[model samples]
Target: MLGFLTARQAGVDDPLRLRRVESTRRVLSLKLNPDRDVDRIHGNGINTIDIEAVEGRYMLSGGADGVIVIYDLENFGGKQQYTCKAVSTVGSRHVHKFSVETVQWYPYDTGMFISSSFDKTMKVWDTETLKVMKVPDRLLPSALSLPLSFSLFSASCVLTFPCHKVPYGHRAEVLSVRWSPRYEHILASASADSQVKVWDVRRASCSLLTLDQHNGDKSKASSEAVNTAHNGRVNGLCFSGDGLYLLTTGTDDRMRLWNSATGENTLVNYGKVCNESRKRLQFTVSRGCSPEFVFVPCGSSVAVYALHTGQLVTMLRGHYNNVDCCEFHPDYQELYSGGKDCNILAWVPVLRASDVEEESDRCGRTALVNPAFQDAWSSDED
Candidate 1:
């Protein structure tokens, strides 16, 4: 890092290249931040958490106690102790009748936010007034799955409506709701009734497509609404960073991938992902990294899997109880997971290249030297 800056001070023309290399190296050296704490504000176990995509400086957390909190993740207090302090919150005094299942900030702005709860209602809020903007009649939580929340922030279509059809929206409780990253008007949902449905919210009267497990088997698709998504309940749903593919996890103990466009099951087999919780199982995919990964909250640990290929990468073990949700920090390649233990764990990639290189030097293994590492040692200045 010093060499990169010194080269700039000395008027080297290629300093940007060195700076980018240094940034990637720092991200690869992620470690658990022992100095920072979550500031234990939630009286009960936290169910869902989201760091605003607009600016990663703040985060929103909703607890099982029907409480909502906004925390300042950055160390702006000027005190070195650096505990994340809650800026504002809506506690038991709020309108939510049951556990607050999920909380999120507007994707493009911070002045507004949304929360979903077990009480069969999802509400919008004005951050300035800290008052309920609109409590819609959505989020009728699943009989077997937890609640879902995503910011479809525009004032137009709130996921406030249940997907049912006779009228064909979700006949059962919508377990998960995610706005399509590619098209702002497109939304996808998973439900307790074992179905994954896509909605082009521009027309609330109908959905774009319904995913069938049979993947075009007329025998099953033709059955009376028997084209269930999973053998059991579909409790989790997430879109790949590019929004080109969708992923779902269910109580059937399996994870499946799909092409978001045509709603075809790509069937990239993620074998037996044990999910016992009847609540929303939140998971996230890594963005802006080579070999993207998916982080899912497993039993007492978070499971890391190679996206698109169902290979198990590693189990991030730390939490002592059932893990419920995990979110990825794309800016730093960090992972934050919350669980029944009432603890939030940060999984980080320890700087291992130096250790591996040392061992390789002792073993006289030339192949261990990656081209990037070899370049780091050989500089134009050298």
Candidate 2:
């Protein structure tokens, strides 16, 4: 750390390089923080959670009990232990009839947010009033598999409605949708029919590309296996920071990387990711890291994997039940995860030994650290 600082001070190293290295180290050292906690508000499992990108000081969460909560993540008070308070909530009366599938704050500000639910309704809400600002046409539940809906905030007709009946789109329910960070018009959708398609919103006549797991290798694919992203349902889809590469997870217990522009499967085998969710799975990729990391919910734990190499970095085992969603706060290099256990766990970067005082203070801090953060690997094999 001192060497990098000295090199940076001497103008011998790039400033961004030092930041990326430190960010990567922090991500690797992420552990369940005993001090930072999110106040429990949901009676049922948390389905989705998102931190606003503008300030990164507020978080939005939706739960299976049809509740939506907005948390103030900024810790203004000087304190070691802090619980993120729910500043606003939408509960009971006007709440969705079923599980709230997703909640997201408006891209530019915190004054507006949007939420969608299994009740076949999507609503736009005013942050201050906590009341519906706009309620679009309620969707008719599709007979195919799940009654999936995408919360697309836009002016286009296709964006307003779930485009299932399109001549060149997924025949089954579209389980997941994500817009590319690099391209405003580029979109990716995963469906129950075991296909992943990339679309250009302006040209809705057909998808720009349909990802193939086989990568156009006909001899290696069976008839049914040809041009499919996964053998089972593809529930998760995430793009790399640059939007040059894409990562996908499916019920087939596998995760694959793909070249976004060419639709070529990079085939970096992230072996047996253990995804059993019948709905959309929310996973995230790390930002400001040299070789990025992927944080995904695998059963009760959040699995960390190397983005390019497909190497398992660590397993964050803090949740008691199946973890449904996780959101990364890039500004602080912290992670927030929610699960069926009705808990939201904050995984924070551990303070380096040098950051502490001499011997006594280090010993005291070590003793107070949560056992859940300790590595349980056995040395017996060695």
Candidate 3:
């Protein structure tokens, strides 16, 4: 009876209820560094963050108050409780006129970065000089419209450097953008007006493909008013490792997958998720697997879902407040989530055998086989 109860508690199916199950487990309170925390820079809440994986060892953050700050993530002074020191700033005097929405590293180089602002511009900046590198006009052609009851909004374009020359395209405020892993020059972007555009970055005019809701092959003009892909504002977008598919989240509290090459909607439903009506959220995909997985920031928790079938696999919960972004580190099989609580939490899967033994030991079951496994289980059971 105790064995049966333990298996059921671990989400065993009816047929396999009695058999010991090896499932992905979660440990909520494992602390990486209780002493060190992300230093706050924004007087208002932070809106976006981008980590540079190369030599500078820096992460860039944009805020609701129109400030951009670069923080050094590495320990320079060899202190136990090292605060993330600000390396440079866009200048408080000449800060963005509107809230900065996104900050991203250049696809090929580490010395350059890009940021998009509600001020209707995407500025490319040289990391060393900390100044605008390229000031190309990439705004959407749509007129600004704000519903009186809700908040004032405008359609904006997202920027990506897939190759040296080919520019990506979007007809609305590009809420999110990502590059394809298989093809270096291929990139994708989602917009508030419910369109996803793909670009080769080498072309002079017209996108390679315009993912419209209507059925047709011809690319529509930027001014054409068409039915949106989602009922609400599209807020988040990501591409799978293979780059064969794309995932999008919206203010309507849903997530959908798409066939990248064909522009066919997979229509997988993640019911009643967070309402990202205003800000952009980040999601990631795990690579080198048969059935790839996607990690989505849904309100206060990160929801892991099967990519192909679009089934909710598990919900990793730890954040005390709404989670704004999540990234999956495939090299370690770990996930990092950051949010309104002003903290980033690292989540790792608990070993299946360990969880089963722990539960069995908690129920006061005796192990007749190996005493070492029993001792190991007893330590964590408490």
Regions of model 2 farther than 4 Å from truth: 135-166, 354-382
RMSD list, candidates in order: 6.9, 8.2, 11.3
Q: Candidate 1: misplaced stretches above 4 Å?
A: 1-31, 77-81, 134-167, 218-225, 352-382
- Compared with the true structure, all predictions reach lDDT values of 0.71, 0.79, 0.60
Query: Worst 10-residue stretch by lDDT in candidate 3?
Result: 142-151
lDDT of 3 by residue, 2-62 (tens): 4445546766535242321212122211124444565666665455666654453667777
In angstroms, the error of model 3 at 236 is 1.6
Q: Is candidate 1 or candidate 2 better by lDDT?
A: 2
Ranking by lDDT: 2, 1, 3
Ranking by TM-score: 2, 1, 3
User: In candidate 3, residue 28 scores what lDDT?
Assistant: 18
Candidate 1 lDDT, tens digit per residue, 73-105?
Answer: 777777745677788877866748888888877
- With candidate 2 superimposed using the best TM-score fit, by how many Å does residue 36's alpha carbon deviate from the native? 1.4
Clash pairs of candidate 1?
146-279, 146-280, 163-169, 163-170, 164-168, 164-169, 164-170, 165-168, 165-169
**If both were scored by TM-score, which would come out higher, candidate 1 or candidate 2?**
2
